[model samples]
Target chain A: MSQNLPLPPIALPGQPLAQSPPYAAGPGTYTTQNPTRTVITASVAGIPRVHADKSVSVTRPSPSHPLLLLPEVASTVLARVTRLNPRQATVEIFAIQGGGDGIHGGGDGGCVCEHTFQGVIRAQDVRATEKDRIKMLESFRVGDVVRAVVISLGDQSNYYLSTASNSLGVVVAHSDAGDPLHPINWRQMACARTGIVEERKVAKPI
Target chain B: MTDRRRINGPLEGTIPPVFLTSSTHKSIIKRSPTTLRKIFLKTGLTPPATGSAFLELPTPSTHSTPTLKLTSSVYGPRPLPSSTTFSSNARLTAELKFSPFSTPGRRRGYIRDGVERDLSAQLSIALGKSVAVGKYPKSAIDVFVSVLDCEGGLGDAGDEAGGGVDVGLMSVLATAISCASAAIADAGIECFDLVAGGVAGLVLEQGGVVEEDRVEKSLEVGQDSDDARRGMRKNGKVTLVLDPSPIDGYIILAAAAVGYMAARDELTLVWTKGSMGWDGDSTDEVERIVDGAITASTGVRLVINEAVKERLLLGLKEMGLIRGKAVSGDGDAAMS
Candidate 1:
């Protein structure tokens, strides 16, 4: 694959990088098939790299490529709870875990976006064990930062997110006295300054 | 008979200030039909935009140089409005506007008029096909082109005497298409190919002798004697010129602007205006005019490719991927 063509260090969009039979297309690259053969081309202007596994990809020079950081289905996102209703909790998604990894890995592991996207956590999707007994107020409150996974790209306005797993719930919250809350267990958080225990869905510490 | 409510100007009418026109204005310089005017293109001018570019056609030595300046900015692949229905592809929109002072004599209105709307639609058509829209589902990409300055032909007296085609606007559209394409490429939008625009026109120079051989060639096309006589009576030598400027002082018979993708060998948009049925077969004339425009676009494509590469080289340098000096040579070495 390396001997196929002398690939330019930087490639413009649509510039062919490698042949598809020996190399598969990866991120920042797409394949186009003609009558004779399939060719992998750079989809963005960036440095084209050929991986050890014979996969060809392009890495954008700028780490903060804005549009490429969009959240997709099954991606873990960190969002702040903005509003609460009888059946759902509205959130503004601020960060997305890079590569959709549940664990926080080192070096470029996540993307913190400038503009937030809207999402919703319905009462039914708050937890997995008790579907009918979930209460929106007890599970989440306004201004609580929660970690969740996108389940569906719902309607025109909001993405449907779920916090059903033990590792996906409120990571940060405040007490009624405006003190920071620390998670004590799966369903409670205590403010050290006020010693006021609050009921909430708590994510297990990584 | 008038009640005083607000302060007003003096009761006596006053004459407006006037200034002398510059005396250094000169006629357009003659260039070959295949040559294109110099173009200066740069990307990433507007910091707030996802991508931006500026284009200028500068004729420094000519006193009466037509000011052709344009800037384009691309925003989004962001979320769509709530009112729009769900879509599996990104929605692309383009808007072209002329600033109030873009033209020389007459001022353009802030409101979008028929000309701006028409150019915007044509720009949208020119850009829509090249983008890989399917990859960005339920998002919107908007391209805005602002014509900062242009050749003064909007309300020129010469336009009425020449053919009805607005050669100035055609050239503006062509430049705008190229500028917007550069901005889109800078935005890192996935596309099959970059689209470059070009314009060509059939110009009739007055008092020039028509070649007898060319006249006989037109006659051989099976046109009636009456048509041949009419064609002969229309005095002047007709020549197809690439990148025609209205400042050239020639009567433009017909003009075509094409948005061409050189790599794919495809034409995304073709706009032609003016009367072309006088001398030769109309269909063949149109085809020739379009062919000329494609040739001009291919020339523009080379410049666009160089500009894109220059920016990429700068990016790679900043990222420390390639070391100082000998940038191009080092880029290849580092990648390999």
Candidate 2:
């Protein structure tokens, strides 16, 4: 059966096959109806405490605790709350805005780089990122522009994202190579030459 | 006196019984779930012009009670259009599809939705990096996907704003890489290294969750480039999960591999451990999602590596890369 198989360049744990170990549990510890986490939790041996949290969850939940979502992802993808069931609410992000909006709209207005970020806003703290929220320090609002990196191609309908970066953002009024445009600080920032006011991500170089 | 016996219940619409548990608090408890045998390498298993593979995923644990099952397929390594095609390079096209019965409710039809379209594009980019396209002359390959069944937290059903569960997609892409590698072997196509794909989704808790990250300068940094994360996320969105069935997003993370060199220490270690991580030491589930995605991606990368090895060995056997030179059977010929 393993004849025509693709052998590993470097030996991996489950060398013969990519299959998992089948099972892992320490009697009563694992039998709990819904433990806080999986055996993978203990597997984080040498990783620093802070870095360890970056791993993704397996199929099963830890019973009560839900997974954490990055605020950066939420802010980037313009997510929206579609439904709120007993346990949680469903947020979906549509078009990443000009200035990068998230499903959570829980951060300051900014862009990651060129891509407009659109965050999904289903539940408040469920998966949004706090670390990113602190950096941006802003709340998401309806109509506010947003954008996001398509984190992953999820199951059927929902996609995953992270606005954790500064570049991926919404483009409110995108300017071109030489498009005569002005910021919307005032209703009209009359330019000395053109005397025209437009909406754009005006660079206010500090 | 008539054979027609009408019931009081309206028959216009019928409700179908569904099975596929959601995630539970206890992850260590190994329960007997459904078998996803239909989604694997053995199935049909062939790419059109170049490489192909199938992605098999255990049921998702996001929604109801964590008994989700999924399967994905990838195909590609063909030729490119004259304009887009490189002189010495091959081209790629990716396709992602979901079965109507794959989800909880009746799914939308055969139409390739906008989200799926975008995802396909991303898959192309994600795998493009590892493929030795330049080795091939004017050829294009296509990647195809089909989701058999999705349950519970398996994926997001929220299409309100054109976002879907990304976890499944990434998982499938990883699987596809495996299949593609196999096909590439069958076809004996050259490549830098097989690129692996994985899902990294945040199952956001309600507030109060701290998490963290990597040293690799993000190919796509925030608030930087004009294309922003687009170049970095050139492939497209990877799914993010808030609570189980609650919130979600799409952020795509591709493997930065050029035949082994792409995988770093962190990624290598995680794969060496044998298991993909779901939780480390943080209350925030998102952290695990991030790390999990990366680690799982490593696993996917390895899978691709194996496929590449097989493909290369076979291709070389066919092309005679490893065979001894045409040694003259006779002594005179040998001398000449």
Candidate 3:
């Protein structure tokens, strides 16, 4: 399918890839408008490919590509809760979901970032319903790994995160006895070994 | 006062032996004014850094000139420090340093000196323009370059006649700019273009009179006769040389270094030093020197393009995307 597209074996930064009329700019490429026409140029050194949808992109080699991922607004992330307070839970963002494919489309699994960024999930954003009745301790613990969506780029210190959806909450947790907990429902998790139940904002099984 | 912590050398010192024939003080190599020294550039040398590169200019056959060696590492697109004010675009910072033993005769200090700081600022400005900073908001990119070995002496002591221009430092700065740009590109940072640095200088031949043989050779090489004549009349037979080296022994009158983007036809940074006249009548002279620097930059850009492509090709080959023959074929293309 990509045979008909005029592709260079490799592309360097600022190398013009194609014109905008036939192909739209994709990842690793940007468009610039001149007096005569718009040109799509490669922004990184990689192999340029033209997608089936008439979009051109320069894809770096797979191994080093994950290092370039960053957490952006409205994107789902996998974060490990590092600290908890009365009003909020601080998390360290470890992986980004859907990679660079919008919010819902999955592109080659998720990209695991090389560096973790600071994020905070406020008490009110723990769930979609009953915002005022939520407790930070019961919803998330310091060691829990939570699935969250970035709501906004908060203050200088942390990225504002939300786990308000049924699918966006604590995906992993441990009981008081330190046994791994399995989700029994949206709000509770039961330990398989200790038979102890803990209250958490649990994510529904996929 | 003398230190008491360690044993010192004997108080009575003996005179060191002196060689009858010293080969180190030989004359410098001679080349055409338009020719530049060959550069060897490679990227991805430091595995720990996000991206790294090494650049070198080999010592001439005479071995009088020291090899110019530089290493640059790039970090980030990572988060900024919390204490800093918020910004909408990515901030780029560059730091250039010389290793203690990189220079001859004297050891450099651990702390950054005024020259290092000045070069760092210039390097930042050169690289900042090529990067698409808007793509990475609220983050910072840091580039660090260390002069592993240096060409030309690192100090201003060498060019006492040049007044303000330090030829050795200018060459080092130019090399550092190119090295940092390669590292940035290797890091996969989004950039509008790759910036290559070049240096050109107006040199005054030792004697006031222009030799008959030299002028005839320059004319035969198709160099502008008017420029040669004008410089002779105005500034004691000044000659413009691309990629001027301090080891050449020529007394430099002025020098210009530029960070040029070949594809975009833009110059990101322009630094000129020395005694170039700033008066209205000397504007053409300044333009001519800058134009010579630009031409030199275009030559360096070709080497950078090949270095980047070589790394990418290796990556593709390792992934089994191309066969061995194709890899060799591409390498041949680059050489040609």
Q: Top model by lDDT, which number?
A: 3
**DockQ, prediction 3:** 0.53
Q: Mark the regions of model 3 whose C-alpha exceeds 4 Å error after superposition.
A: A99-106, B1-27, B59-65, B158-165, B205-236, B277-280, B321-336
TM-score of every model?
Answer: 0.86, 0.35, 0.87
For model 3, state the Cα shift of residue A169 in Å.
1.1
Clashing pairs in 1: none
Residues B1-336 of candidate 3 have per-residue lDDT tens digits of 777899987789989988564332233667788998899999989988888899997534545557789999999888888897777788999999999878765577899988899899999999999998888777889999999877646655453423224577878888888888898888888899999999998876645225434543443564664554444335446679999876665556678999999989999989887666534457777887889999988999998889888887666555444446775554444333
lDDT of 1 by residue, A1-206 (tens): 34555778677777888889988887777898889999998777667777677877676554234335566788889999999997999999998885452111111567676468889999999999978999999999999999999998888778899999999999999998899999999999999898899999999989
- Score residue B62 of candidate 1 by CA lDDT: 59
Q: A1-206, model 3: which lDDT tens digit per residue? A: 35576667778999998999978998888898999999999998887777788888777762544337667787789999999998999999998885345311124567777678889999999998999999998898889999999888777768899999988999999888788999999989999997788899998889
The list of candidate 1 runs beyond 4 A from truth reads: A1-5, A63-67, A100-107, B1-15, B22-26, B59-64, B155-158, B205-237, B277-280, B321-336
> Could you tell me the lDDT of residue B59 within candidate 2?
30
Best DockQ among the predictions, by candidate number: 3
Candidate 2 Cα lDDT to native: 0.34
Candidate 2 per-residue lDDT, tens place, B91-129, comes to: 656566667666544565788787567656655665565
DockQ, structure candidate 2? 0.01
Cα miss at A128, model 3 (Å)? Answer: 0.9
